[model samples]
Target chain A: MGRLRPGHLVEAGFWLGLCLFLYVYSFEFDKNIEIYKFGASGWPRAIILLMAIAAIGQLIHHYVKGDETSSQIISAAVDDGSEEAAHAAHHETVKWYLSTFALLAIPFIYMRVPEWIAGTSEPGDAGLHTARLIVAAILIAVVVYFIRHHRVRVMLMLPLFFAALLEDFGFYALAPFFIIGVMYLFGERRPRPMVLIMALIFGFMLTMFVKILYVGLPVGNIEPFYSIGSWVVTVLQ
Target chain B: MDAFNNFLQGSITLFSDPINILIFLGGVIGGMLFGAIPGVSMLTLAAILLPFTAHLSAEQGIMLFSVMYCTGVYGGAITAILFNIPGAPENAPTAFDGYPMTKNGQAGKAVGAAVMCSALGGVVSTIIMMAATAPIADWAISAFGPPEIFALVFFGLAVAASVGAKTFWKGWLSILIGLMIAVVGLDPVGGIERYDFDMPYLLAGIHFIPTILGFFAVSEIFVQAEKKVRGSYKAPKLSVDFPSLSELFAHKFAVIRSIVIGFFCGILPGIGATLAAFMGYNEAVRWSKTPEEFGKGKLEGVISSETANNAATGAAMIPLLALGLPGGALTAMMVGVFQMHDMQPGPLVFLTSADLVWVVFAAMFYANCSILLIGFLETKTIINLLRIPFQFLAPLILLLATVGAYAVRGLTIDIVVMFLAGVVGFFLRRSGYSIAGIVLGLILGKIGEQTFAQAMQMLHFEWSGFFDRPIALGLLIAGFLTLCGSIYGAFFKKAKTPQTPDPDSA
Candidate 1:
């Protein structure tokens, strides 16, 4: 038996805590009916109990055998041995935490700020549109700065941002920029092929999903973009 | 005879529509393209297209998936042989002998064997699937009650959890997490919410489509993006030569053995094509006269692996159709498709949607045959798709995933759920947990819970009543034994000494 790592203990403890919380929460469910002895909470409670047991068993097993097997497997799956070593060298750096926080927070800000601004103003107010544009510009500048330095983090944050803005900005108004932005982030420098690819993808989505399938893809809620989205759909139909 | 008649009638109806023929051919081509790419799995394409299935007829939708499943299993062999990259996990075994052959300048012969054996295995398995599915469903309809069904689900989850993880405990924990996810909405029996926390979206239950997309597609993009940052991909030179009839005839017995292994393995709930491929290769090596030649460019190795994986594609559908138990993630997504069409899989589905079921059978059979022609003609063209960088495709895939998630219920919340699931899946994969086990648990948990409640009610809430039913008792015992075996292997087995890390290995 070897010594367990702190990371292993934390992972095991997370599962144990989660299972315990859910098990306690299951008590809030309605009581058992006449025909059913255990009712709605029974199945979840049973599952949670098993999960807690597994978590405890895992903690003990790691304590006895160490996490070498798991570490090797994870390292192998993620990268070459040298790359894993490199990752380990900087695993505890503040840069990693900051990058992850930025990746998560950018999308939250992108999705929430507009709603916050809209909540304070009337729907058709000109000031609301201007505020949104200013916020969007600042966010885009921040993303561009990160893209120059932390390409992988920006790659991850791009999808989250896309999801956050997709419904409000609409598919047509937002998709081409997304395609170009992603291609550019990926180091596709040539503008011609990027434009061609963007057009092809945009056209395909419009034809297959909107024209043929009649999927109610969102048009933007705001002016100009909203009219543009509807106009394209109307033309396509 | 009735099954054969149903199959014939299905062929007639399917061929009657030019549009169906077009969709079938398109699915085959699309499946191969997706599967041949290193980063893209057929599951990504399937998840992206799931929303569109709602607009098509049930036959078209199911047939599209059926053919894709058939061709996708074979398409991965192209990359495995030529580039040393297994397009999907199931194709990983092929690269052992396949890449060695490529290095030896015998890539043509390796590919030829893979194509022939894959088609043969798939066709044979489809025939078996068609013959066996109706009878199995009939037997299940006759024999299985709520208790038996619950026990079977339990067995399935246990076996699912036992395979495909760094340890049995991690696998089991993943399954428990998935079951917890499934328990979020209103309870099936009493309609009492378990974990909804008073949100209307949560009350309807988390839709599985977004979860599937997030776990399989978005997480895959994240994985690939990290790889892209670490390394560069190069295109492989393509060469293919079909084997002579005489050459193929020499390996007929190996092919037969693999087909048998693959089909049977595919039928087992939660065991899928990846296991079948490895098992086939293992059995081939065991039976070979010069077993030492297997990993060193033996054609039998390629034949066994490709054959078994493709064979499992059809057989994997049997459990999904007969008992509504999906053997893997792709089939689990198929369950979502079935629900999207307002149909439930299982015995009653055969009674209600016989035509659709038969069409799927015919489509799979035809899809396998089409692979023979298409694999021969378009091997080079398909390999060309690898030239497109993963960076370019990642955003497009994310876009599709976003739309696919939202289009399911026209809910923005589903998109959020999908992204969250993707992040969770990425971390889960990093930690060496089985995403497939989690998925299987999510799909089966509701059914298991419903049946458990009904079974308890029928038995007057006596826990011991399950033991009175022989089939239920047998299944429960099997599940218990599987767990015990996993525990024993985890603890009682001697641990291997840690070795120095190999710097060159990727």
Candidate 2:
């Protein structure tokens, strides 16, 4: 919360360690199949090697040249706000990270649940297989944990869970409407008109990619829900 | 003699096309708009407009793209002088003196000098490009065997390494990182993955669209995230007056010198106008009787830098249009545009499409004239763009960065890439490393890789192949001399600062 420290050696070490791990893992490539001359792992290996070397060079610079000036710059960055003010400001920031993490966990949790009350037992394709879907969900959650701020995390989940659910309930186009409602209105505080403008923009994008571009989307068990999209696609064809 | 006569015929053919003039004017104006705007990039314009050129003949498309390249560079000076913020990365030097000058109530004069100087610079570069390109292309087409290419790649990498702070190890290390990132995709020759990590995207390695947006646009957002961007710059109330005769004559030597230096720098693949501007600015500062006036609002500093940067634009096209070696991003875009219209860019390009080459040369000259006109007429309007409040601007900037990042791959994956790159950039800055060199190296990494690999293969993996290529050998010598120049730059820059207690200790 005070500020991030500029410890070149620490960063250099971490990246170097990651590079080594990636290289070591690359050794497990199945050579039984002749995909290409160098195999799948060659490019990754080269990247890892170069990254490791770069990290070492960074460490060397730290050791020999010693850039204390940059360290002071980092310290000065946070000092503008007194330490107390910074401490107080940090909590709200952390909340966004927490929310984003929780939002990401939803699909994974649903996957681990053994049985659905009523729905298709099997997903449509290989990518949508129940096991793969769960893995994908978990991957997203983990990635989101590292990536997004926590405050909007829960709001992000509102899309797939609620909107996608409503689409199955026969409100096909309307299901996406709820999504805009939740993310734009509920997530951020703006006057209703501004929120409406944002919602319309989102709607336009939905219409473009889904209806105009004819992108395939899963609408759950809801029949007659995507009639508008289907009609548009039919017309274009 | 035959090629020369054919070239003359081609020039006549180019001049005969009325549509070519319109294309030239449109490209220059559009390029100026793109370069002045924060989110709009030269590559973006080139890529988007390429499809439209599919209907035209190859020569017309090449001419249009060249205009875009030339004018996009000229436009950066507009925002740089008016706004404290630099619209394009290359305009950083312009912001230093130009912004300070604007605050000194010479906004009109600064814009005038920048526009005029840039025009002069570009015109000089265009002439040089036209004169030098044909012979150079002939030489390159014959000489660039694999060994020469290998040597050239090494030279480019070394020049990239020369740019980062004094530590050679750090610079090399950065190049190593860039090369590693470049190595992730499938091998072109061997047809195998090196570091695919089993991800489908990894198979393509990293595309320029996503990577450029990530590193340039997104990282910029994160770095400036905590700070306010928009500064209070009232448009100065005045007329567009040309520099007085004596004032023009006083800076004649610097202007001519910068154009020459910038042209040479531009002829080299990968260095581009950014370095040309910096070189010009440095020399101007060093020679200035009022070196102290530079960052405080000296018109000479602005004139030298703006002139050289725009000049480098036309010069960069010479290597690309004639020799099939693009010296910068804008010219690289030109190569794509040319290919789209079925105009192959190479040594044979001039021979097969002489009219197209002449059209591009003609376009470069006209684009300078067009920018000059726009600069003269719309001087106040352009300066007033600086008056917009930073708070309102910053959020819009973030949105644009996000939208642009998303547009790159049409993948959410790129959005994630943008965020990651920003954080990485932030941390790199925190670590006292020069991101400038690393970013530049990343951009050039693939060029070096493909060139090196091809060159090596042609040599049958012989080490001496690099030395055997005459042009490659010459470039190596040039690269070595540049290192010496950088050292001298550092030494002199330090020596001039008398206020520092211990210059030696520093």
Candidate 3:
């Protein structure tokens, strides 16, 4: 037991946990008609056994044949203190990761929480999408607050998330405008030519994929959005 | 002779189409460009182009893409020899010898030898691919079953175990970790979610792109980021050279040896071009009259390495087409594209799309020819990729990584998975565990599962019934030997004098 390595210990611990969880999986599986002499549990049980052997094998190999200690591996990793120094010295966008985590967490909440209470007005607007928008708004507002408070890791999520959404809203026409807005915001305040670049890119993509391939896009009631393609489809029809 | 006639006909058709000619040229050019640009990986290029060619005849589409694969591998040597930055993994062996040639004022000669040797190996492997494919496909079709597939996966895992790192235990650990991750999403048997905890997207299992990108590409980023911050980042002088015929003829046997090594390596199933190149170089160094001149400027060095790398391309495609086991990462992408095109890739595919497979073989031929022609022409210009500033280029690649991951399944969850995987990969890589095994594992996991699960059903879940199939037993034995051989080779090989950094590269 003492011969076990930290790696194996951790791995074995995981396996032990996984074995317990397989019990939950068993509930969903067929209990009728044992396929093997051991039933369906035969293979998964064998897998657990293999995991234990592998962990033990690792422990024995390291303890018996190896000479280097854990400190050597640790030192080899931490020897480069320069990276941490660089990060410290060049630190600017502080709330970047915070916003990213919040955004990721909001989606998880949406998956589980049917009636979340964050906005001034409850997103209990009696729709699935309404809940999503409210969650997005909360995520965006929380991120913006942190970005303003800390002023590092420049939170670029608000612009990027909204822009990607615009492509869905049938402002399929306004998609390029979104890129320009995001690019300018990302570029830190010069959003003009970047906006134009987005327009050019959208036009190019539209001509290439949509026009040439005859694929349709969601024009989302944005009236100016659906024109040439719709007319072409009509002509063909 | 019928197969030979088919190849000749493929060649004939290759010349008949001017559009194909332009594609061949474009492939060569694009290959060189992508190879020289360190962040623009061939897998990314192959994956992106896979969908765009949906309308083309299978042979034409394959011909276009194979050109990209073969040339990309060859094109990487330009940067390796000129800038000392191996633009691709297989090119790492070239930088060892080719950059030394540049320092000795024979950059052109090194490049020439590399191109020529790559051509020689490619032609040999292409011929071998054409010849061996039918027989292998026949046997593979006859033997294909669940037990057989499980045996193949075991063998693949063994290859990863034996070849991964110094310690066999860590390699096994790496494989296990990959298998665990692969178990995420739906259980293959009844489509029950195993690790997803009830998420909707998890029901389909983890889309492979995120896993592969995490294991290979993102992990690479983590490694680069950490190393870039501390290492003395130097670039090689962009001196270009091509070797004379005499210099190449002297190494003709070396080229043959490397191609043989590459073919065998590809047949083994999971290990890819990098190993083939490394193995070829090691053998060249071992057998050379002046073994001392290996890591220094040697025409034979670049020749031996590039030839094997390119040869592996055709070699890898064999199993993917025949048995539906993807030969490597690029082949896996091709398999995905094949599925997207509504063509199942295994033996049944032979009966359904025999003509399409021939088209693929035909495309492989033209692509090989294109690599030979345009690869040489693009060498002089490949050095400009290093000119891009690191600060700007790194994030651009990260953004592309996000886009690439998202494109796979049209999910933001993929992007998040990609980001997390990248970070995990970075640590695994620095710690010396092979990421290759992990990627191979994730890709092979489902294939392994379906095969294993099916075998279970076939046997009436009998434990002893799995080995009843001669083919399954044969594959098991082969896998065991391969695993043992790789471990013996990697661990027992004597260390040479530790290599120093190339001054020209610095």
lDDT for each residue of candidate 2 in B1-506, tens digit (9 for 90 to 100): 64446446655665666776567667877777666654334544554455346556777877777888777777777767665545554565776677777666676777788888888898888877777888888887787664565456556656655443324445555556656566667665555565677789778776544454444444443333322111123444444555665886789988988898788777676667767887788789888788866777778878888888888887788767655655554565555456555555778886786667776676677677777888788766655553543323333333334434444345545544554554454434423344445544554556555665666556666757657676777877877775555434332322221111111121
Candidate 3 residue-wise lDDT at B10: 66
Interface RMSD of each: 4.5, 9.1, 7.9
Candidate 2 docking class: incorrect
CA error at residue A49 for candidate 1, angstroms: 1.6
TM-score each candidate: 0.93, 0.71, 0.77
Error of 1 at B299 (Å): 1.2
- Candidate 1 regions exceeding 4 Å error are A1-3, A67-98, A113-133, B494-506
Taking the tens digit of each residue's C-alpha lDDT, what string does model 1 give over B113-211? 887888999999999999999889999998888999899999988887766656668878988888888999888777787787778889888889899
Q: Model 1 chain A — which ten-residue stretch has the worst lDDT?
A: A71-80
In the range A70-106, model 2's lDDT, one tens digit per residue, is 1111121111111222234342244544554465455
lDDT of each: 0.79, 0.57, 0.61
DockQ scores for all the models shown? 0.40, 0.14, 0.13
Clashes of each: 0, 17, 17
Misplaced by over 4 Å in model 2 are: A1-6, A25-51, A68-237, B1-26, B38-65, B164-174, B221-224, B228-242, B332-345, B352-356, B385-447, B474-506
On the 0 to 100 scale, the lDDT of residue B306 in model 1 is 92
Model 2 accuracy (lDDT, Cα) = 0.57
Ranking by lDDT: 1, 3, 2
